[model samples]
Target: METGKSYFFVGIGGSGMMPLAMILAGRGAMVAGSDRSLDAGRVPAKFEALEKRGIRLFPQDGSGISDAQQVVVASAAVEDSVPDMVRACEVGATRMSRPELLSRLFNDSVRRIGVAGTSGKSTVTGMIGWIFDRAGRDPTVMNGAVMTNFADSQAPFASALVGEGDAFISEVDESDGSIALYNPTIAVLNNVSHDHKSMEELRTLFGDFVGRADAAVINTGDPESAAIAAGLDREMVLTFAVDRDANLTARNLKPEPFAISFDLYIAGDFRQTVRLSVPGRHNVENALAALGAALASSIPPPRAVPALESFTGLRRRFERVGEANGVAVIDDFGHNPEKIAATINTLHEFPGRLLLLFQPHGYGPLKVMRRELVAIFAQKLKRGDMLVLPDPVYQGGTVTRDVTSADIVADLAPAGIDARHIPDRDAAAAHLVASAKPGDRIVVMGARDDTLSLLAKRMLDDLNR
Candidate 1:
């Protein structure tokens, strides 16, 4: 319940838990954690970084919890049956959910901003943080991906940075309903779409997230977010959009193959011409949401717009891995139905046959959005489009094996999509590299695995050779 305590995390290798553990370790707390993945040899580089931070790693076998004084923290993904969780409870240790622990520390900051959205959350989080950093305003920023702007020798773009300044910025989650814990000075909602929760649940969670903030910045173009904007008190809401009348809107949206550019407008008056190093109209929309957050923090448009242009984008979210011998390989973190459609739809504006390599994140999620996923690929992919799918990325969690990429392939095949399941990363890469032509965009798509980008780059190298 207090500071200066030794803490043990059940899933330390998780994106959310690792950053929080690192912050706790940096704050001089004795922090150690364990993960089933660490034993499985996934994300070994991340574990090495944590070890360098003086945080020891352990197996998720409950052996790490040696004393009652050591608090145990874990994510909702960690089951009660997990050995670490069982062991922590056996020792009468205090346990906290990842969000619960983050809230306690995050709420203590003078300026806490939570960016909530189904997609574009990571990119918007990174954009806001970069604005603050470029302005010389040291702010603690927590993001899901490595922000290119924050990539440097000392931090190595650690997903989160604990700055010496008063501001605390984090990407909140409404899909898991963990966003309820956040009490923020400014809250930004990018857009609402399905992944883990129902639309009804998401609407309430996102609406309530905005209500908890002193001021809410929302995307007016999105119907779900616009509904939240309408219900908010005039003084409490700030809206951004590309079409509708909003406090901030991007007009003249021009999207190219590799990047998107638009003009920013406020209340029908022209503000500035904004350019993004990232592609798609979705990214342009993301930039507007980020601009609103910076404006809410009293950072001028001049500073925010330049920072947005300077943004090289996050680790995923349409990240270009390599362009070997004119074959461009992209790595994107788009697993859900809507997000997948958006990425595919946007690539239509570019110059290439959309050669998509989709690895489902898990069997359960792929099953949950099975029909929608099938329809998206069937609708978006063209005649010559190619799809390479690996089996669902699952290590331990129980899932119905019947529900898989094969199911999606079966559905897509009926619609004439050249889709097949390869079931392994290496074969998928080899097949893609061998088949890719000069104008094919070889995109590796999925989430939860940090090494997908590396695999995408390797595929590009193989194609070049």
Candidate 2:
């Protein structure tokens, strides 16, 4: 909580942990951390970049907890038996959850805009951050994914930006119930769907998140988000919709394989024609949410539209890896049912056969959403589309493997889908490469596992050969 104090993150390279650690280091704090990936000698480049920026990196051993004066920061994923946690206990260092520390820093800002949802939080957060930055607000922004707009030679993984301005923007997480921690001046709820929690629990958490904001941006297009907004005072809410009437609305929509164009209407008045470089109708909804949040913060619609138009996209969301011999490879982070459905729907707008390699992020998610995931894939993927599955990526946890990718593949086969369970990712890649045709589009989809991106590249190389 104080400057010049030493802080060590337990899982520093995690999507949520990395940006918060970077923000602390940028604020002149003594930042250092350890990660399991570094311990296993995987993804050394990300940690090496942190080290070059003056943040100390160590293996997940007990060595990072050098003194009692340091504050040990960790996420909910870190258990008590971990070496860093044990060492922190022995050394008497003050321990804090990553959310707690992030909320502390976020609350200190003059104005805060927090984006909360079941999906598209990272993209919407990046959009708002880019809009504010382009408008010369110089806002301090935090995101779970790398913003392509901010990626450069020095900070290739530019997930967080430290700027001198009144606004602090971040994507708040409800999966861990950390969305309740921060009180924001402007809060944007993109959509509420089942991810890590139940519908009742998600509704309660998101409702509280919206109720706490001075001005809330509600997505009326999503029934759950609309329900949450209905309970709150209508005067304090700014609504955005694609289907019905709202304070800000998107009309005359067109969806392409890699791009979309739409017209913007503010309060039933024609504002301007907006175009997005990103695909999917969901991204159109995300743009509306970002626009509403910007308007709620008193930025005019005209000023924000240009930034949204120029917004390229995030790193893994519908990112094109490469193309060779009429075969193209795309890397995406769509593990949950809603996310996967969105990506598949976007792909249907184009005319290419899909060869999908999906890795479930965890065993618990597979168990919880197995039926919904199967139903989604059955409905979205046509007969020509093929699905390949490997075992879920395990990052050292005791989990119940009650349901697996094999079960989903079995379910899909009965539904007329071309699904296969290979178990081994390497074998799956080889099979996909061998089966790929000239017009096939290879899509690598998953989350939490950073190696999936590398696998996407490998598939592209094999296709080229």
Candidate 3:
């Protein structure tokens, strides 16, 4: 949180690390770091944007860490055998995990809003940030994905906003049990599902998270979240839902291809009819979560609702790249079952045949949720819908690859789904592009890898030809 200190990030280009580095640099700290992606010549535009903001980028070699005074920030994925960690240890530099530093900055704020859940965290975080910005709160925001509203040519990766206000908004992570680190003035729990952790472990983590906050914005529509909300004090909890009853509810649901609209109700009275540029009934749930957060932060319904109308959404959360030759290509961060279901269901609302190319984020997650993943695909994918899977993303780490994308495809075969496992991502993309036809939607889905966006663009280009 020190403004004048020097900090070096080990994986600066990562979704979580990039934004923290940007926040530190924006606050007048000397920020420098290295990423394996940068060294491997991937996502050059992201690193270039960092350099433009006066952040120095270095290769992942040990050369980046020299001064003992520099604080080295690394994610959990970065092993001790990595060159950066080795150099930091040899130089006696201060070391901190990415979540440790982020939690420090978050806990220091006078008014903090922590968005947490298995899915919709990034979208809800972006929505709350945009609401605050539009309401003239000038809140500082940190997110895991690029908020398209804040993105432009100069700041293409606008995941973090450095503000002079006391309000700090961030999406806290629960995958690594780091959700406990955040202490929020207003906590938003969107939903709880199976992803990266067991149901029991997730309940405890999310319970403790909302329990620490002075006020909580919870999704009562989700059974797990509703159960947690049941235990909390009624006066401190603001609940939202799409179905059934809650403090804040959405009615008259109407979903479109790229957008959705619904009526917002507060405590049994209709407040306003809300429309989001982002698609899905799930996003309507996310909007209610953001409205609950804004309400907790003392922002009026009029101000928050108008801001959400203009909310453009995050980069990879069902982002439509472009349509070419009558085929539409979408890039999505749908690695988990819950998120993937949202994307697939949203698209199914329309009449297009889905050509899905899902790249598993990592082998570890594939191993954990293989059954759920296969079940969701089997249940959701229609008869004509085609699915192709590439090998799980492995970034040279020591991991147990007991399960792979091939396993998911094999499981789907029993359900009569047309699924294929293509090991190479390029080959998968080629297959998807070749299979795409008029009125077909080619969706490139995954997380943890930045190159997926580029692949989506390449598919659009090929379709155009």
Candidate 4:
């Protein structure tokens, strides 16, 4: 957490790690790191972007850990066999997990708003950060996705904003059990479902997360979160919901093809009619969570609700790639069952056949949620819609291969869902383009792989051809 100290991140180019590295570098810290993707030239532009910010780059080989004085930071994914980790051990360097580093920095802030949930963490964090920034709070913000509102010529990857304000806003992780590390002035739990852990484990983690906060903003729509809210002191908890009665709620919900409008209400009194450019009912829930947190920070609903009107949304969350030949394509970062369900449900709100090209983010995640995912897609996808998949992304990690994308397809087949496995995204894209008809909405969904966005654009070009 020292401003002027040197730190080395093992996987620096990752969405979570990159933002923290940039934040430190902006704070006058000597920041440097290495990534397998950067070393393999998978995403050279990301590395170049980091270098432009004065961050030193190194190969994954032990080259970066030259001195013991440099604290080596690594994500939980970085195994012991990784060269940088071995080098840290060899040099007796102070090694810190990515969460620990983030927790230290986050806890040091005068005011902190921790956004925690299974899904919508990144988007809600971005929304809250944007509101605070637009309200002239000048808050330092960290997010897993790039905030389009903060994007500019110099900072294309505007994931982290270094501000001079007292408030520090960040999306905390409950998947890796890192949410317990943060003690926030306001904690926001959007929803909790099966993602990286079991329901029991999630309840324990999220329960502790909210319990430690000075005040908590709970989502009543999510049963698990609502159960947690039941135990909290009424004075210490603020509630938001679209389903049931709550302190704050959204009523008369309207979902359009590319946007949704809802009447914001607090304690059954209508506050304002809020319109979000972003698509999906899930985003409506996210906005409510963001507004609750904003109110927790003393920003009123009138000012907070207006800021959501201009929220352009984060990258890959139902982002429109382009339309060609009257067929529209969207790029989304939905891998888990909840996220995938949300995306599919959102698309259903409009009248169009869907060609869902889903690339599983990781083999491990697929193995964990395979049955639930199969059930979700089977239940949500209409008869006219089709589901396609490449293989689960293998980024040179050791994982169980028993559960493949083909397994999910097999499970969906019995449920009358037309699902296919192509094993390669390029092939999947070609098949999708060939099968897509006018007015079909082709949604490319996944996470972990940065190339998904590029693939989405490629699909648009292919359709145009």
Candidate 5:
């Protein structure tokens, strides 16, 4: 992240790429990029916001990579056949992967906090960032999702906050094995589950991730995370849990529709009652993880716990779009089994039938977790609940389609779950809206796609009609 260095991101509008581009631009680096979404005329607001920041946007053609000194940054998903990459090679521009550059900047920071896991990474990172900001630490924070606490009219996408403090907080990804690149002073491991990689591989990656950190904050309730904690020195680990005894624990959880209240305990001593604006026991676990990171960073409980009270959460994690005609629509980033289960469990706490539209994030993920996805939907959806599936999101990548959304729907049928495979997302939304009752909750769940939020809003709008 050298000052005044020119960087061009191939997939500039992506969740991971957008924040890094903003951070680079904020730090005096000349930033510009291009996206296929921009070419397709999708999500114009996101491209408009980027252009407003003086980051030039171009079509996905080779026109964006003219300068030889301009460094081209791309995610692992970007194929070498992309015109930008080909043009970069033609122009002899330096090429760097997104994680490579991000890790470089993360490793350079004096005090780095890396939040990792299969689930709750974004929420926990947002919580830690909000706490540090409220404490006046002026920390620079990077996250995959927009932090609603920092989002406003000027900066609608506040995924990255650039500050002058010594702390640099970011969520490190293990799905791509890039978690090894980060070296954190304080590391937070929420939980491990089957998402992108095998449990054995995830364990090895997570174990080494915390191994590099000076202090690790782990969730004892998760068996995989607890196993990792078992091998670490007790003095170097700060453990948190809701169902198990740990260094930090939450007791007497009171779940609400959109918020939750719980008693915070530290080492068996009662501390204070914590009321989080975000709902779900998963969030209660997330809160404990963030507080553990803050504690490991030497921030007092009085200062850190109170900031979570004001934390409004991320944009797509169970974000309520609107309520119309007694039916509520929620937009969620619940692509994996664990995240989907958490969302279902939290919503089921109240008395409402759930009409779910779960678009698989990718064809590859469907192939990887076909059985797990089917099992989660069958186990979580009650007899009266309805489920709809759109085709997995495909953005011009070559992938095997052996396991499609139809397979998932077929699998759910044996369990007496009412599920349908509506290949078109618009038709899926229509089904969700048409089937939604007065006391039902219409939930749009998926990841890797920004249009899901817009779909949720449209469902609410149709319900209003």
Candidate 6:
């Protein structure tokens, strides 16, 4: 962290890796990195953003690790199997995990706040960042998603902010065991669901995460999170909820397509009634989490309210990609049952023939949540709605052979929700556009793949054409 230290990242284009790279490069460090897949060339937007600030990109051929003193940073994904990793060991280079580097920087800061959750991590992270940003805390914030608040000619996504203030706030990941690395002043856990790893592992990781924090904010509605809140070191835990009693809660709940308005109640006394720009009960839950996190971090209720109001929602979270011929195209990252149900449930609020085009993230997740996916679509999808499935995304990694989106479709089609398996995404998009009526909504859903958003936009463009 001292001035001018050369840092080489193994998997630099990852959402987590990109923000850290930009932060370090912005700090006047010599940063360079590599990735295995560069097909879309979209990662260049990330590295080029860093390159604009003087960082360079190289192939993962060990050239970036040439300097023995270089700090080689990478994620758990970057194993000793990779050449850069082997080179780092060969050259006696100081190696670090992405989270470890982030923790080193976070711990060095005078103040730090971390947000951790399974579902609302990005949205909550964006909310906390906005609250502090508007309060003139000018805190350095690292987020997984594009925060539209700080978009300007210089930084569009605003994933990493260079704040003048001492507070260093970030959204830490418990799913990947990175949350264990962060020692934060405040930790926010929105809710823990099945995303990565098992509940036993997540419990240990998230429990340790909140234990290290000066204060831990949790969602009492989720049994897992509530248990974690109860288990954490006493007097440091702050709870937020919509139903069950907690330290800070959002009561008098309401939901709408345009926004969700609710009354905020902290401990016992009545707080301010606020309206979230985003829709859904899930977002209402997200607001409570953000509200609690910001309040525990000492952000004034007045300041946090306006920041939350001005928030424009995250990209691909029930995002309206485009509309053509009266049919709306929506793009969302809802590969899991909880996420998928949330999106479809929101769509049900508005009047339309819901046409869903879903591609599972991977074979492993498809197998893990196979029954849940079937139930989500079967339960939420109306008789007026129809679902189309494409094959799980494959990038030549080892995957379960038995798992496929088609299997889920077969399971759901029998339930009579108008389910069909269309393996090719392009064909599925075309089919959706062709079959969609004047009042139909085409929702493109999946995660771990950026092409879902692009495909959603393309589907709209094709429909309009």
Whole-model Cα lDDT per candidate?
A: 0.85, 0.91, 0.94, 0.91, 0.94, 0.81
* Model 5 misplacement above 4 A: none
Query: Candidate 6: where is the Cα deviation over 4 Å?
Result: 37-47, 232-234
3 versus 6: better TM-score goes to: 3
Count residue pairs with overlapping backbones in model 6.
Answer: 0
Lowest summed lDDT across 10 adjacent residues in model 5 is found at 1-10
Please provide, for model 4 over 298-352, each residue's C-alpha lDDT reduced to its tens digit, 9 standing for 90 to 100.
9987688879889999988889999999899999999999999999999988788
Worst 10 residues of 1 by lDDT: 149-158
Looking at model 1, residue 316 earns an lDDT score of 77
- So what's the TM-score on candidate 3? 0.99
TM-score for all models, in order of appearance: 0.95, 0.98, 0.99, 0.98, 0.99, 0.92
Q: Report the CA-based lDDT of candidate 3 relative to the real structure.
A: 0.94
lDDT of 2 by residue, 30-130 (tens): 99999988899877878987897799988888998999999999977789999999999999999999999999888899899999999999999999999
- Which stretch of 10 consecutive residues in model 6 shows the poorest summed lDDT? 37-46
Candidate 5 C-alpha lDDT tens digits along 396-438: 9788899999999988888999999999999989988988889
- How well does candidate 3 score on lDDT at residue 209? 98
Model 2, runs deviating above 4 Å:
none
lDDT tens digits by residue: candidate 1, 1-465: 234879898888777887788778877899999988788887687788889888989987878899789989987678888888888878888888888999888898899999998888888889889889988888888888888777666666478887888889999877667898999999999888777888889889998889989999999899888888889898988899877788998888888887889988887899777788988888888888888888899998888889889988888778888787778888899888778888998888876888888999887788778877898888888988899889988767555776878778988877988998998878987988888888788888998777787788778778877
Q: Go through the candidates in order and give the clash count of each.
A: 0, 0, 0, 0, 0, 0
Write one digit per residue (lDDT tens) for candidate 6, span 299-337. Answer: 868888898988878777888877799988888878888
**Poorly placed runs, candidate 1 (over 4 Å):** 1-3
lDDT value, candidate 1, whole model: 0.85
